[model samples]
Target: MPDYKAPLRDMRFLIDHVFDFHGHYAGLGATDASPDMVGAILEEGAKFCENVLSPLNRSGDEEGCHFDNGVVTTPKGFKEAFAQYVEGGWHGVAADPAYGGQGLPSSLGLVLSEMIGSSNTSWGMYPGLTHGAMSAIHAHGSQAQKDTYLTKLTAGQWTGTMCLTEAHCGTDLGIIKTRAVPQANGSYALTGSKIFISAGEHDMSENIIHLVLAKLPDAPAGTKGISLFIVPKFLPESGERNGVSCGSIEHKMGIKASATCVLNFDGAEGYLIGEANKGLNCMFTMMNHARLGTGMQGLCNGEASFQGAVKYANDRLQMRSLTGPKAPDKAADPIIVHPDVRRMLLTMKAFNEGNRALAYFTAQLLDTAHLSADPDQRQEAEDLLAFLTPICKAFMTETGLEVTNHGMQVFGGHGFIREWGMEQLVRDCRIAPIYEGTNGIQALDLLGRKVLGSQGKLLRGFTKIVHKFCAANAEHPQLKVQVAKLNQLNQQWGELTAKVGMAAMKNPDEVGAAALDYLMYSGYIILGYLWLRMALVAQAQIDNGSGDPDYARGKLATCEFYFKRLLPRTATHRAAVEAGSECLMSLPAELFAL
Candidate 1:
């Protein structure tokens, strides 16, 4: 396995130069997160991840989680590492101060998450799910519920999980068989089994809080009847074990260290959260957070694989360079000298860096949405978030998967070996595109609900921002051609949406058929825009003789590579979208096999 170094130099570049995060923090009223504090946090967070978490990654995977009976014990050093994580106060860096948190901006928390995930994704799951639960309770839980759960969670005294998937249902929550019956005490008794519950049962935290979905007896049918519940492994007041138990943990292909449990809640006491029969609405608060975090998993695995691949590429000598031997004294040139190897490396670099930019930009929007005191500003931020969230979740993961695959290929046969740890990244990343509402679901949500559902208002919310950006930078000296290309693609994006919208109005299947392709197309454009943004800043630094010119040049070069190579993917997706639904729908379901 490659040594996981937190990419602090690139992180600093994005935070300090590209995004101007200090100005952003000031505007968001996060005065506590000043330049010095942010700097200190980044350095400290990097050290903790590299020195503490990274080392345990391979070992954790090797030992996996041990489940005997109902108890799930994490791999060696996991419990200790988690304890160190909590002691360092990393759990609540972005939580509300009123709830025993440091109350920094959400973006900072996400930055830390990138490191945690890259270093030890399995361990990160313990807190990743907890943070999502915190968001849900903080947003929709009752005051009493908040007081009971949020404080302990923020203090890392307890951990949490979002339990929605059942054997019968995954994305379709309308048919969930879980039942929540009313009790005299105003609480409900929840009874059902949830599958694929990450951190559902663990020894790392004292208690496990599950925000579950179930149906009440008096509730209506389908989704309208669904309700959210707070089902803890142990009753908070009594400290007695609740009826919830881990029936078993999954023996999975990857993330073996993270306990993926099959939880059985047998008449467990649960408190209703938000309005009755409105559970899905409330759970979305947590799901969205998890979706973004899942997207980061792509970047996380990609980064780890890239680090390993790059190191191996630099060290592994193959045939001589096409023109001449770059290393005459060393038998043959390194694989890094090969064009195909460079292609893979550069592809990883472009996607990783561009995706980071997108993640940070979206994180900034999260800060705006959460911290802005002005209602209108908050609403605008919320709209942008709604539009971007699916793209962030779906697109980043897709590109991230591609990046990891390329990284593996760069290692040739060694990449496929278990000892190198590259294959583990591939397995770990495979789950990302499948979960957080499969990339297909995310695409439908993006094209069907978020875009056309809003009559393009939501889509406009983002494209307009890109418009202003392109208009402002239309005549750059070094990057003018790329800017023009981005501008044209931006215009084409709107036109493509209009085309799909018109077709979907006549046939709703058009939306489903075009959604995945449309989303991929949208992703390429968004990344293109971000690449341009970073390139513009990099070129400015180069022009004015400020910052590291070498770093700036690398940014510009990567941006060029993105435009010339990856951005062209938009054409293929666009073509598929224009191909329409007939080709997909013409064949009967039974004909698929035949």
Candidate 2:
């Protein structure tokens, strides 16, 4: 059977050492998130994932979800599995206490998300969408809306989804045909068909709260006219079916167990969540939450693939090592003995660790953005999150797909087969880059909006942090090389952004041309800084003395591998970014087709 074990040790390393959640929570005055409490939470969360969720992953995929007569039934074990999850009090780990939650730090919620995602991504989605909905309602919903919707969502008695896409529009929400008419009783009659709604219609919850985006009559044109609505599957007051119904679910390439529904709202009763004509703005609250979660999915998949690859490499014997057979008793050495195999393993490892640092750091910033008392700190954190979210969404998932591919490659032919389970990881990871706004869109957001829109202030927010870290650790005896390399990249990031900005002014297409490469280049540098931070923590642990030698040594070695092997990829991206748009746009649109 396919298997997964939570990387509790590494998570603890980040929580206890690198980001120092103990200190972070203490600073936030989050007394409930004490180290022991957090540790217990991680331990319990790990058990739920490893024991409860992991066992269902392969079974869920093989069986998938069944759609019949406008009804969706999850794989046999899913309902039960989700029940255990809800019973564990995990549904509201980070939600507000007033609404049946544990009232822990939001970062802890992300920690559980990573675990659940790695264990069973499809299963994870059932409750995952609820988080984004809860955030949207909390941030924008009125007290009545909060009491009616948030209470049930936080308690896991109800689930939620975001209904945005339609037949004609996916990313272009302005062209969506969904319409809402204001009624005498204050509710709106919502009529539209929304496609690709994950967890939109499911049997796991008593009710499903859909946050729908539609246009009001006489509303302005395009995305600006869009208005947000809360359309529940069961009316909160009447307890009767609302207009929302499951038209059908898509036959997908992967994540099949998660219902991707075609929801038809035929005069469905919905209450406006935010001001009319400002739905897009309100929807961003949910989109951003989901975007970050999607990015974590990338990391989770890479981590899952890496775990499989490591186990397979250590057990699967192939050819002799260049130096000689390390396993002399066997016919040939384990694949781990080969340098090429080691390269792949290290690549996955470096990215897994580096991305975890980035995610955790971003999570810390999220806590500050949401909870910090200091306005400046909150704004700085929010500004940095705006810059990091797209990078997290795009770069992590792209690399995640690469890692899954490599994991399967490690198994050679066996990886392609269903029995070993490596291929499923690849298939499941493919959607992350496509959904949550395509990576291309993410790049555009980074270069066109976040980076350029702010006149480079947003980019400066993160780069300045890297600059400060480099300055503080410049003279370190053990990390001088990494610190130097980081400083060089740190300096170059600003210069490259400036160059792209100048080129974009001369030709706006230059931004589009350079966006993908720029995002990747930024990702590498960001990971480089994260790796440096991790190396410092690992080095401190080693110097502090007395612990598992392999864990500490492994951390240092992987940091070195990232600097030597992976960090240099930024050069290629930098060259691509500097190449401008002339070569890219010179060809006519019709000429290439023939």
Candidate 3:
């Protein structure tokens, strides 16, 4: 396994030059987030990820987590690594200062998350889950509730988990069998078995805070009746075991080091977080966080795999270039000399860089949504976020899977072996698209609800962004080609939506049939806009004779590659979406079983 090094250069480029995060922070009233301070934080964070976490990727997978007698212990070095993480205050970078957090921008925290995720995603899950739980508490928990849970969670003395999935229900929260009966003391007694709970029951934290969903005794049926609860593994005041226990840990493929526990809550004393039956609303707060984080996991896996592939391709001598010998000094030539290898490498490069831009851009939107004092600004940012979240989650992960497969293919047979670490990336990333509301579901959310539900209003918010960008760069000599493509795609997006909307009116199945393809189409254009933005920035740097020449040139090259090679795939998705529901729905339930 190649040692993971944080792509600080690219991260810095996006923060400092591409996005002007410094200006963004000042606008948001985060005066303390100076360039020097954030730089130091990234520097220190990179060290923590590179030295502390990267080494654990393979070891953690091999050791996995242990389960015995209702206790779950993480892999070796995980406990100590977590303690060091807490001591360093990395857990509270983006948390509120009112709750003992550092009061920095959430965007900065996302930067750290990318490093942690790329280094060791399994190790990242513990703190990742805690942050999600903390976000829920900070948003909706009562004053006393915040005082009790937020501070501890912000400080990383306690960990948290979102308990939603069950044996019978993964996406359908309406079918949840968990029950919460009201006790006279304003609390509830919860009894349910939740499966696929990551970091659910672990020994690293003093106490585990579970933000659980269940049906109240007198509530209505289905999702409308669901409610959120704060269930702890141990009573906070008494330090005694609560009714919650780990029935067993799932023996799974990949992410083996992260505990995926089947938690059994037998009449566990749980406190209601928000109004009864509004749990789904509050749960979205946590789910949104995990969804975006899952998207980053996709970026991480693709990045790590790309790094390995590039290194191997440059060193593994195979055949000579078709034209001539590129590396005449070597035995034959490094496999990188091959055209197909370059295609794969460039594809990974294009997505890895394009996705990074999207992630950080979305991060900036997150800051605007949370920190802006202006109401309209906040709402606009939030709306854009609501529109982009599903796209980012599904599109990035799907591309990540593709990138990793390409990465593995570069290695020939060695990719299948554990020692190479390429296969681990594929196995680990396989879960991202499955969990986090599966990519298929994400597609529906984008097409059915966000786009069509609003009559293209939500989508226009994003396309208008591309609209302005294309308008601004319309005259650039080198970029006009891409700018024109973006302009056409931007217009095509709305027209396509209108067409799908018309079809869906008559046959609702058209929405489902067109969704996944629609989402992918949207993703390519979204990424196209981002790549163009990078190209413009990089071209300006090259023209001015400023910045690192190699970096700038590489950015320009990849941007061109994406436009030429990758962006055309959007057309296929467009055709698929416009094909309508007939071909798909015409197939009866009782198909030809010949």
Model 1 reaches what TM-score against the true structure?
0.99
For residue 573, model 1's alpha carbon misses the true position, in angstroms, by 0.3
Task: Estimate candidate 2's alpha-carbon lDDT, on a 0 to 1 scale.
Answer: 0.92
Supply candidate 1's per-residue lDDT for 334: 96
TM-score of 2: 0.99
lDDT of 2 by residue, 63-112 (tens): 99999988999998999888888888999999999998988988999999
- Candidate lDDT scores, in order, read 0.93, 0.92, 0.93
lDDT (10s digit) by residue, model 3, range 1-594: 768989999999999888999999998999999999999999999999999999999999999999999999999999999999999999999999999999999899999999999999999999999999999988889999999999999989999999999999999999899999999988899999999999998879899999999998888989999999999988898889889999999888889999999999999999999889999999999999999999998999999999999999999999788999988887889999898999999999999999999999999999999989999999999999999999999999999999999999999999988999999999889899999799999999988889899888899999999999999999998889889999999999999999999999999999999999999999999999999888888999999999998999999999989989999999999999888889987888788564
For each candidate in turn, the TM-score is: 0.99, 0.99, 0.99
Question: In candidate 3, how many Å is residue 399 off?
Answer: 0.5
Ranking by lDDT, best first? Answer: 3, 1, 2
Badly placed stretches (over 4 Å) of model 3 are: none
Off by over 4 Å in 2: none
**How close is each model in CA RMSD to the real structure?**
0.8, 0.9, 0.8
